[model samples]
Target chain A: MTAYDPARRPRVAVLCSFNVDLVHGPLSEALAARGLPSELYFSGYGQWESDLHNSASELYRFGPQVVVVYPDLRDVVPAFGSTVPSKHEAEAAGAEAASALGQGIETFLSRAPGATVLCTGLTVPPVNALGLLEGNAGYSWRSAANAFNAHIQDLSEGQGRLFFLDIEPVIQRVGWTAWNDSRLWCIGRMRLARDAYPHLAAFWARAIRAMLTPRRKCLVLDLDNTLWGGVVGEDGLDGIQLGHSGAGLAFLEFQRAVKTLPARGVLLAVCSKNNRDDALEVFRAHPSMVLEASDFTAMEIGWDDKATGLRRIADRVGIGLDSLVFWDDSPVERALVRRALPEVLVPEVPEDPALHAEFLHGLEAFDTLTLTREDIRRSAMYREEAQRKTVRAAMAEGPPEAFYRACGIEMTVVRADDFSLPRLSQMVMKTNQFNMSTKRYSTAEIAAFMRAPDIDVHALRVSDRFGDLGIVGMAIVRRDTSPWLLDTFLLSCRALGRTIEHGFLGFLSRRATSAGAGLRALYIPTARNAPVKRFLDELGLEPVPAGGETFHVTIPSGLVAIPSWLTLTIEE
Target chain B: MSDKLLYETVARVLRVPLETIDIDSSPETIARWDSMAQVALMLEVESVFSVRLHSDSLMALNSVRKIRDALVHLGALPEAP
Candidate 1:
C-alpha cells in the first residue's frame, strides 16, 4: 500500500465562498485515509476573488499544485434566494452568471502559478418556481444550474489541467437536505454541512491521487455471479441467464461493461472458483456471453480460492497486486481476497442485479486523466509480449541481454510532430520509473515547446523481432548556445534496461555538441526515478557543482557508439 | 452535564482536550480558537445543540459561557444540561 507522505503529496488550497474551518478536519482525515496527506491553504470566507487576484494572497504564497474552488449557487448565481424570476430572465441570468464563473476560473488559473483548478458544479435548488417541471424544459433553477455546468464543462473541454467536478451526482446520492444542514448554515455560514466535508473533499482528493500514482494496470475479475446470473458449473451453459431477457439484461449489460475495460487500457483477468472447462464453455459456446475468451489477459480458473487466483493473475500480468481491482459478486469471495491481498481494491458490487451496471459505471477508481496511443495499443502489446516470451523460452539463452541481441532490435528517433505529440505528452505525464525529471506536460504544452526555436523534442520508437513498441521514449532539450539544458528525458518502462537511454543521451549529446553547446542534464532524485539518476551518474556525467544534481557530459563531435544490437535510424 | 458536553464539543472541534476548555476560556485565551477554528466551533455548537444561533450570538460566542448562555437563551440545551 502506498503510505501517506505529507511532504511529497501535492499541496492543495481550498478557496471557498464560505467559512471552511469545519472542513479541514474531515478533509484531512479523508486525504490521510487515501495515503495523501495534504498541506492545505484555506482562504477566509468570501475571499475567493482576493485570493486569486491579490498576488501576495495566501493562495499564491502556498504555491499549491491543485486549487479546489467551492462556489455556492447563492453567491455565484443571481437571485439564488431572492424573488423568483420568469423563464427568460432566469435563462439570461444563468448565462451571465456562468460567464462570470468562467472569468473567475480564468483569473484563478492565470494567477495560480501552474496549478490545476477544480471548480465544483453549482447545486440546483430542488424547490424552484417550476419545481419538477423545470427538468422537462425551459429555465427553472435546475435548467439554469445545468446551463452554468454546461459552460463550466466547455471551459475544461478546450483546455488541459482544468476540470469541473459535477457535485450534482453527489448531491443526488446524499440528498439535498442532508448535504446542506440549515442549522450549520445559520450558525456559521458554512457552504456545506460539517459532516459533508469528507464527501466534498473526496472528489478533489481522488483526482489528486490519480494524478500522483500510476493508474491501476490490471483488473482481476470473478466469473459466475459477477459476470452473469447464476453459477456456470451448477446452472450449466444452457441454463445461464446471460442474454435471455428481462433480468438477464442486467447480466448482459455487466458483461458488456467488463468487456469495455480493455479498450480503455485496463487489462482483464478471470479468477473463478469453478471448473476451468465449465467457465471456458460460457465464453466458447454460450451465444449470449458478451465477453469472448480472448478478452481476458490472464485466467486462473478452477477450485482455487480467489485470493490465490488473484496473486497468480497479478504475477502473470507482471504487475503488483496493488495495481489490480478485484470484482466479485459473492461477499465470501470478496472477503477472502480482501483478507489475503488487502492491497487489491475489492469494490462491493450492489446486491440487486439491476444496479450492477450502475455500480460498475460509478467506479471512479479506474479514472485516468489522459490517454495515449501507447494506451490504446497496450493490450495488443502485452499479448505480443507473451509470444516473445514463448520464443525466448524455446531458445538456448535464458538472459534478457542475449534475447534482446538475438531479436534484431530496430530503433527510430524523430522530432515530435503531429503524429507523435499525443504519445509524447502521455509519456511525459505517466512515465515515472525511467524519467530524469518527473515533469508532466499536456499535448498543448508539448506543441508549444515544439514550436519554440530554442527547444527540441525527440520522440523515440523501438522494436524487436516480436513487435514494434510504439513511441516509447521522449527527450526534451532546451537548445541554447554554450550550454544546452536537458529539460525532460523519459522512456517508458516497456523499453527500459536495454541501454536504450544511453543511446538517447548520446544522441542528445551529439545534437548539443554540433550546436556549439554540449549536453547538460539534471537528475532530481524522486522515489520512482532512481533508475534514470543512477544511469546518468554511472555514464560519467560529471556533477558541475560536485555533489549537486546538475550534470554535464561532453560529446566529441563524431559518431557516438550506440549499442551494436540496435539498428538505429534518426529521422529529421 | 450539558455544560460539560458543550466543553467537550468545543474541545473536539478545536482538536484540544476536554479538560482544557473551561467556561471563561475564550478565543483570546485558547490558542486553537482562531478565526478559522471559530467557524468550526460555531457550526458544531449549532449541530450539537440543534439551535440556530442568531448572527449577533454567533459572533459573540467567543467563550464557553457565551456559547452556553446563547444555547440556553434559545432553549436548545442538550439532554444532560
Candidate 2:
C-alpha cells in the first residue's frame, strides 16, 4: 500500500444535518484502509443548507471532488419524527422537505460543477409518531421518510453525477439501537453512536472508492459447498441442496445475490474441482438454480488448482488478475489461491451458509459509481467476444485483416452530447492501456469541452456482427492550437484487437486535414500504457525534438484513409 | 486497568504526548480539549474501559481525574482507597 500523500488525495467535504464530526477520524481511517487516503472537510453542525446555498461558503472554497450531503429525518421532517402530524401534513412535509433539499442540491451542483455530490436518503426513526399503528396508519413518519427517499431517487433520475447514498441497509446492518445515540444527541447534537461511526464511515468510504477508483471486474466462485449447499461431485445433481426450503434456501439466496451482479457489470466465473459435465448438468437440469449457464462469462470446472483457474478466467474475461475476486467455502482452497496469486482478492467465506449472501453484499470490490449501457451489457459483450474468439481460432491461418473484416466492424463517431457524456467521462477515467496521455476529466469538464467552440470532443460507438459495444473510444482535441493537440485519445480494451483505433485516428486526421492543421499527440508513458506506444508507431508518428514525449504527424489532405472494411458514420 | 492506559488513550485521541496528559489535565490546560474533542475523548474512554458513562458523569468529565473517577464508579476500574 502507498503511504498517505496529502497533495495527491481527493478532497472530501462532509455536510450533515447534525453534528457529524464524530465520523471525521473514523472516515479518515476507513478511507485510508481502503487505499484511498483523502482529505476531509466537515461543515459546522446543521449548516448543510447554508454551505450548499451560499456560493462563497467554505464548502465551495474547499473545492472538493466529492461532497457528502447527509440529512437526518429529525432535521428535515421534525413533525414526522416528533409530532403526530395528520396524514396530509406528513405527506406535505415530506414533499416540501425533498423539494427544498433538491433545490439546494441544484444550487450546489451549479456552483461546484466538478464535484460529485452524495446525498443520503432519510432513515426512518426507530420510534415512529404513530407507534405500533404506523403500518396500518394512512401515512406516518415511516411513510413520510419513504416518500422523501423516493423523491430523492426521482431527483437523481437524469443527473448522472448526483449519487444518492441509500443508508437504510447500513442502518439495518448496524441496528437502529446501535446507530442512534439520544444521550449524545441531547448533549452534543451527535446523532450517531460511537460504535456506529466506523461502520457508517466504512460505507461512505466504499461509495467514495466506487466513484474515484477502478472497480474489480469479475467474481470467481467455487461450486461445491459455495454456490450450493452440498458438493455436486459426491452428492450428485439431485442430492445437491439448492431449493426454496431447508438449508438449500440459503444457497438459493446466495445465487440470487450473485445473479444481480451481472446487471451491475461484475462478470461471474466458475472455478471448481469437479467434472465439467456435472456442472453443466446442474445448470441444465436443476429447476432450483437461479443462475443459467449463460450467466457466467468463463467456466473452469476442472481438477486444476484454483490459482491457475483464476488466471484463466482473467485471461478469458480480458481483465487483469488484480481485477478478479475469488470466493470459495473451502478455507484450504482460498489460502492456496491467496498464497499463489497475491494480486487476486480472496475474501474469507463464513462457515455458515446463511451469512454468504450478506457477506457478498458487504464486499465493496464490485461496487461501481456509474452504470452505463455498456456496463449493463458487459457480461453479454464478453460472451459475444468469446464467440468472436472462436471464429478467429477457426480461421487461424487467415491474415489479421481478413479476420477483422469478417467481424463486420462498424464505428459510429459522434460529437460528445449530453447522452454520450457519461460514457465519455468513464472512458477518460478508466481506460488506461490504450490511452495516449491519460487525462481524467470529470463529467462537468467534458460537458464544458463539448460547449467550447475551440475544442472538439468526439465519442466513438462501435458495433459488430455480434452486438453493440457502446461508446468504446473517445478523443478530446484543442482546435485553438497551431498543430491541433490531441488532449485525450483512448479506446476501450474490449475494442482493441480490431482496427477501431486506426479508424478512430483516421477520422481525427481527416478532420485535422480539413482544418488545414497537423495533429500532435503526447504519449506520457505509464506502467500499463505500453500498448499505446505501439499504436503510435503503427501510425508512423515521430517524436518531436523538444525532449518531451510528444508525437507530431502531418496529415496529407485526403491521404489518410479509414480501414476499407470498417463502415464509418459521423454525426455532428 | 492501569492509570497509564487511560492517559495513553486520552493522549492518543487528543494527539498529544503521553507525558502531557496528567491527572490535572483539563480542557483549560489542554488546547485541543474543545467541545468536539471532549465528546471524542469520552467515546474513546467508553471504548477503552468498556463502560458507559451516565449523562451526569459525561457532562462533568472535563478533566482526566474526573474521567478516571467516572470509570471507577462504572466498575471498570478499582475505586481509590
What is candidate 1's lDDT per residue for A318-400, written digit by digit as tens? 88999999988888878888888889999987898878877876687788666655677777788777777677788745767
User: Against the true structure, whose DockQ is highest?
Assistant: 2
Per-residue alpha-carbon lDDT of candidate 2 for residues B1-81, written as tens digits (9 for 90 to 100): 978889999999999999898999999999999988888888889888988887666667999898888777778877762
lDDT of 2 by residue, A396-436 (tens): 99798898888999899988898888678778889999988
Model 2 lDDT on a 0 to 1 scale: 0.85
Cα displacement (angstroms), candidate 1, residue A461, comes to 7.6
Worst 10 residues of 1 chain A by lDDT: A550-559
DockQ of each: 0.29, 0.45
TM-score of each: 0.69, 0.76
What TM-score does candidate 2 get on C-alpha atoms? 0.76
Off by over 4 Å in 1: A1-9, A79-114, A129-138, A141-143, A181-187, A239-250, A303-308, A329-342, A348-358, A380-415, A425-572, B1-11, B14-16, B19-81
Question: How close to the true structure is residue A346 of candidate 2, measured as C-alpha lDDT?
Answer: 92
